[model samples]
Target: MATPIYEFAQIPRVDPAAPARARTRKVRAAGQAPTVGVIYNPRSHRNLGADFDCSLSPHVHIAQPRARAQLPEALADFAAKGIDLLVINGGDGTVRDVLTCGQAIFGDDWPEIAVLPKGKTNALTIDLGIPDDWTLQDAIDALDQGGRVWRRPIAVSPAEDGASAAGMSRVAGFILGAGAFTKATQAGQSAHKLGAFDSMVVAVTGVWALLQSLFASRANPWRKGARMRIGLGASGVPMEHSGHGDPEMRQLLFASTLERLPAGIRPFGALKNGLKLVAVDQISRRTTALIPLVLLGKLRGGLRERGIHQLTASHFTLSIDDQFILDGEAFPAGDYLIGQGPELAFVTP
Candidate 1:
């Protein structure tokens, strides 16, 4: 049998001459129900093949896309219906797929988004301050009564001249990581199998990563890191090196538009908001020993000299020799552009 090639949904082309549609907030009149569209994922960790309840409201619309290829049509239908709220009933990966597909239909004008933490890793929900037990009913009620939090997902695209840039498309996601962070993400899968999710998985995999990096020799994959180059801002200025281990290699690179992280870890140090990134170069074991404190915001002094670099940028370009983790999935390695998507209003209790 021939190997199957899976095709994901692509963003449809829009006419340049067409006027941009205004995405004004729809205010419901007294006793009026808002139009809602939900994208539910049955394969999410918590969903676990269970059927989603579809008898919520007359105005509610639900589409459970079994694969990513079905998202575009579903979102197009929602856009045609002029839904006031867009509910994503899954974990981070589902959110990534929904947003990436919706870009063509919704563009910068998106309906208020609501996320239910129903995945093995709900880091985005932690940033949104959503409880794990939140339901569609809770999200619906909050549509009118709850507050709105503004967030921008990180948008990643292949660089025009990148090796694999021929037919790659832009993807929207909340978290992006590479190098040993990629290895840690792989370990998180095992943690999930042991009944760990969210913060517990973070705690478990984090300790393992630290131990592996601490006790192992510099030649270990955890310490050797991946070879990559980062260029900061629109001008593409080369990122400064801290003169630690090999200047061309970094042990880890983590970037996100999220201000808060699961387990309350502060990898970006004092930097908050916008697109924040932390790059770690191979360092002495003494500095590696301080990883816990560094994540706890306890050690902030002389971090640059210690081979830890954290900063916020409007955008950045990454060229890496290894695959990177976005949300929970991995993307091929190559030159790529990373930036923030439009600000999206998220309903929160």
Candidate 2:
């Protein structure tokens, strides 16, 4: 199990309702060429030393943030310019950083957003149904012609009040997971090195993890999983234990706000919209073998008894004893409040 990196006393709880969001205001006419802002990350996987058609139009302003610290200023400039369409030319990490920094700048009144799948994993774009061949010019053209998909990123912050204000910080992302899910993310890095990405990496990692868990001993970290208490909604209600395996350890815990996941893994079963999560208990080898079927939404009856719990909620609190993966970044093991951020429109081709 991953050890806690920060003492619980050091991390303050955050008010889920406290995110600052200003009211929306009218900015531009429909016929006007939208003022565009692109936050491009040179270090992204696909952009490594590659030159892209950076000029969609002269009005499209681009900022390359070499480090996370430069992100705020870049977003602030866009906010000041009153950009109508904000295009993110990186992957999920870039989108997470931009959203985290832009939260305070644009608030609830965000400009229309676009994602260029330039990173190793572009789950957000996948959920938005963006085409793999989408380019800057395509996104720019779509600003006027494409459809809009409105989504709210999941907000995760320290559970202690006012802790997020003291540099402990909060993050917003489409997907968050812990336990074996984190291990799979680490393994996905190796897959990425082997030239796998997006859905391919997801499928590869899923197979590898399923095989390992199927064959490994119960003590195996992949099967042993993590100790976590997930509380649903404002009342902090504990999830009902299915009594299939270890009560305290969830073998697989994955959550997302995305309507569609990368590999078509319907872990959420028929549930969709809002915040969706699937918590699985350690099960027998037969059940372990059925994981692929479960992921494909093939095995469905009596899943909760089989140790698969799929549900949706407005908000949740995760008090975990292991590091959780948020958009490919490791967040220290601590109590965290998980809820929806502002619903913003994403332009799609």
Candidate 3:
């Protein structure tokens, strides 16, 4: 079956001429109304047929970029207008595209950002405390009165010698997962078919995977996991292996820069800043049954003996023999360098 695309309601398209008018400007000032630019994605699940409040004065500019390639042009136009606040109007995928494309345009000096949680999954919003019903007006108001949360996105790039044939090697996002995580993402599709989304989907798939791993034989896919070598920091020091499982393989590898995650899963344990990852080695069935409690922070100590390891570092490298999921997209198996991007401030209510 072809994959289904979920789009929320879309507002009427903004006038095509508005961008040109918006470009006729200089830089912003302390007292002037801050110039705002919005990158609206009409295809986001919660954005289908939705109407946005477009009457935010003349200083506000909006652009609807239909594809990922168009994101760079849209962001470039915004940068040229000297926008002070960059509003992203979709989900995590849209945010990833904007960050990846805007890197060349904004360099190290990025404008303040706000996100509207109008998509199937808004994990970033969960961390930022953005309301589900937040609108453009709310985002604008928050720009001045709201709290600021600083976060750095995860940067993924192919190793110099491992670049693909097309040389398309770099992308920036917030979440990364491998091993059973890839299967869990595949299972999430089924959860979507059942009308589940957000944390509910996470809870459902996580529970199902736990049961499967707890009961299935050693030969089962969930039990078999994936072959991976994890290296910590710049020196590429090998991750230590627990004697309970295969020394070279990890049953699960999940990494992220966001603090709060959906379903209250604390995969990073107590390590909350920068790049954090949890690697699970193939283990006995008893330990598999206790996995949920481990994630809930109920079980402590002897985790390494149980074949679970959580650590934080400035950066890391992953050499894997299976595909992994970044945000919601699947990337080919190879060597990758994962590190922190610019620390950006996100406006929140």
Candidate 4:
């Protein structure tokens, strides 16, 4: 096979040092850019100039690294710099890094963050009002629009920093992983160049991936078994034992903070208003029943008993093997604990 036909400078690394607020981005106007900050996992960056030039506005204060190794230190650094608003340029993992950085730095002063959709998932970006930008102009619109302030809930986990599963990062704007859904991104998760950012191109990629999964599933030899313990409100009473029961099936707990999954996962939009807890108990139970409602691209669904837009947990702890996937970015960390931190703010689109 031939080598990749692209340059090497367009990758982004995950660094948590409080990303420096966007100072001289050029697109930001004096007193208008808000206290902007940028964090990108360059590996997720496409070599397209639109990705670079569109974000070159004066409003952007950037802290970019060539690899993911710089994330922790960068988050710490950005926090020390004191950013009022953070504009992340990578995918879901990078978004979580920003959330963690906010908690590490200005705890209560957590800045409202906007996600600039640039990665394969761009999951949080679409969760916000912004979505996949097919054209260069569309990309610019996201940049200009992301610089604005919007209000949204930040999933607060009661766990301490770096203690829970993936630490105390915000949700609603971030994705979580638990089951077969997350294990499928190995082929298309590239942050390389010549990235086909066109809308139709994404459609084709979706179909191709599905076909591969179907064939691979036929050849695979794994049967359902106990992977971890999970639940909805309590740890294991069963969230879906009432109808269409699966007395013998064991549901692997695969949850995401967002209402929808990246790429081919589905949603009609019901997930926009509340946090979704996708679970596995017995195979007969439906996980994310509202997912179809969300995939339809509509944001209507049943609300919590109190009509709340988000769920606040004292601290959700999951005990399992180290099989958890964070923001679709697999980690080598042990799965002893996992949850959201105290309080971090997220600007939904």
Q: Which one wins on TM-score?
A: 1
**Candidate 3 segments exceeding 4 Å error:** 1-31, 51-55, 162-168
lDDT leaderboard ranking: 1, 2, 3, 4
Task: Give me candidate 2's TM-score against the actual structure.
Answer: 0.91
Q: Give me the displacement of residue 159 in model 3, in angstroms.
A: 0.8
lDDT of 2 by residue, 1-349 (tens): 0112323332333344566444334466767777888888888888885655656577789898776667777887887777878989888988887888777667678889999998999999999999878988899889889999999999887786643532345667899999899999999989999999999999999999989998998799899889999999989899878887789989878999998998898888888898999998887788898888888888889888888899999888898998888788777777889888889899998
* lDDT at residue 260 of model 2 (Cα atoms): 91
| Alpha-carbon TM-score of each model against the true structure | 0.93, 0.91, 0.89, 0.57
Q: Give residue 135's lDDT in candidate 4 (0 to 100).
A: 33
**TM-score for predicted model 1 compared with the true structure:** 0.93
lDDT value, residue 215 of candidate 1: 94
Q: Which 10-residue span in candidate 2 carries the lowest summed lDDT? A: 1-10
User: How well is each residue in 1-349 modelled by candidate 4, as lDDT tens digits?
Assistant: 0012211121222234444333222234554644456675565544232335535656446777554346546655655555555667766556655554444444445555556676655655554446555432343344445344333333433222453413333332244444343343333444223454323333544455334433443223111322444433435333333222233332333444444444444432334333445443322112234333333455344422211122333234554443445555544323233343444445542
Report clash pairs, candidate 1: none
